[model samples]
Target chain A: MKRRSAIALVGLTLALAACDNMANQARRNPYELPYGSQENWPVMPLATAVARDEPLKPPSPPPVTMALLERGRQRFDINCSPCHGRLGEGDGMIVQRGFPRPPSYNIDRLRNVPSQHFYDVITHGYGIMYSYADRVEPTDRWAVAAYIRALQASASASLADVPPDKQKALQ
Target chain B: MAIFTPRANLFMNAALIGAVLLGACLLLAIRVVPVIGYNTQERFAPEQPIPFSHKHHVSGLGLDCRYCHTKVETSSSAGMPSTAICMTCHSQVWRNAAMLAPDRQSLAENIPLRWNRVYTLPDYVFFDHSIHIAKGVGCTECHGPIGDMDLTWKARTLYMSWCLSCHRDPAPHLRPRDQVTTPDWRRTPSTPSGEALMADYHVHTENLSDCGVCHR
Candidate 1:
């Protein structure tokens, strides 16, 4: 009987120890895990001067390509169209819902600003807008900026801006 | 003198005990089985600050999961949409409806809406949305037909063993990266088989069940 009881005790201890493994343990929020973004990761140097009193332009505008613009359009529709409106008229569904109205991109103030300003706002956020740094990847930010610039130009464009070959179609 | 014979009394007591045991067993089946079974919850939809319908937004309006849960692809949590996101259209479309009063109040006070979480994991189970998304797991795999849900409930049992079943063999649930957010996506003959997807996504089964994979 003594031997049998000892064996049972050993078995129970083994079972309890197995249950004590890390998988069964409770973890806290913000767990220290691998593969997530880390603060120690290298940061890329700013490609454009920080915007202050004077507006700074990007070293060069991202090469305008159909694919880039398409990507920009999709990203903008997902991220910016909520507040900026699908056409960047500052009449997005959210704006209608009673959020603070952002200035229309078609406005002269926004149209005159360099593409870098848009990127800065997206990266750092402006006014009541939250920074989309985590949501919008850097390349996509540039694409969105480029797309916004196109939207601004198109908003105010005249028949003169249309290609001469395509002008007849409009007429 | 007695109301019944002793044998009859014994038989009656036995029957009473048997009925009690049967009732206990039924109670256990109702309460315990759902906790253990896969995708077997009774679909209890909790009340929320707003009656947000996933079906209306996702299926009717054709909004992508990423439109509101913006960080699903990049962060640990599938972050909730801010009140501003809700008002973007609500301010114009349903301007004065009583249903939108909470949203209007939240925006006016500049306070974040306290949305009740439907699906939550225990603190011990560390799940990352980005990793699962990058690994090609569809949103519907665990969320369970969210686009059809009028009011979202915890769809899957989310038991550890259920998680292990997928972690051990994930190919069957894997899909093309583009279709991860496509809730209605299903495997077709032309689509790569689970084994091919497993190879393409490089989902090695060996380390997936390791305690540290989720615990740490």
Candidate 2:
């Protein structure tokens, strides 16, 4: 009788296994609401992360290279160009859609500001802008500041500024 | 002997054949039904609190995927755009659109807007978006022509076999990391060959197909 009961139990478990899905299990996932939290709003994960072995305050470093500029351009185009525009003209799509127009990088005051000023603004947003400290990294912020300088430079750069060989490509 | 008619042979044969045919039908049904049952809805767009158009936002405005899905390159979960992110434009553009009433309400109430999920994997699957992205897989490779999609739908069934097909040979799907979020990216002649990219991205296929890679 015990043997028969044991066989029946095994059969029951096998049948149950057919219904039990390993997929779509009931465990908590990322971005799901925290369990029984009182806050009505969506609780976001902490986004303040530093680069490996980096200091709390990363000053805009020097020895900027072509690679650094390229990285800066990519990160800037993704993060800043949405509102600041690709050319830093402050005429981004979001601005066209009606967000407050940010000052163009070509403005004299902005042109005069140090690269550190741009880095600080990105870390702690300027008026009407939210802090992008969560999105843009410390190193990338310097890259962006450098790219802004490049944009400002390009706005006024003559054919003489372009390398003679590559100048034909521009034409 | 009289009870056994000649027609009894025919009846017995018919019964045996019918039983075998029924079993075959059952087997076919078992194999076929669930595939259709589950995968049928995957292609169809589900109802959402807001009818957000990827075509309008992505294709029309030319916003980068990282503009909203900020954590795609860094985290496993491609983070959803918060209500504030929506308001960055809507607060100025469509401040009073009836369609955005839910968004307004959620923001005012300080409650989360429940966006319906489009691509929920089986809980056991530990798929990392960042890793695939770092390995040079473009958004279009998995998500399909997202820029063209008006309402998002699942492009592929996140089936194990489908995953293994890519994990076994990841080269064909790779792009330059710069073009990872580009919706219309196609490999040009200048683009490196798959073998070169496999070396470049450090993708070792030898253990990619192992069960523990995903199950754990």
Model 2 misplaced regions, further than 4 Å: A2-20, A24-26, A33-63, B2-17, B20-24
Q: Write one digit per residue (lDDT tens) for candidate 2, span B52-110.
A: 99999998888899988888988899888878778667777788999999999988986
DockQ values for all predictions?
A: 0.17, 0.61
> Per-residue lDDT for A1-171 in model 1, tens only?
999999999999999986754533334343233234445323333678553433343344669898889889978988888778889988866666567789998877887888889988987888767777656777888899989978977888899999999999999
Q: For model 1, name the residue pairs that clash.
A: A93-B88, A93-B89, A94-B87, A94-B88, A94-B89, A96-B91, A96-B92, A97-B91
Off by over 4 Å in 1: A1-74, A80-114, A117-138, A146-171, B1-32, B35-42
Candidate 1, chain A: TM-score against the reference:
0.64
Q: What is the DockQ of candidate 2?
A: 0.61
Each candidate structure's count of clashing pairs: 8, 0
What TM-score does chain B alone reach in each candidate, compared with the true chain B?
0.85, 0.91
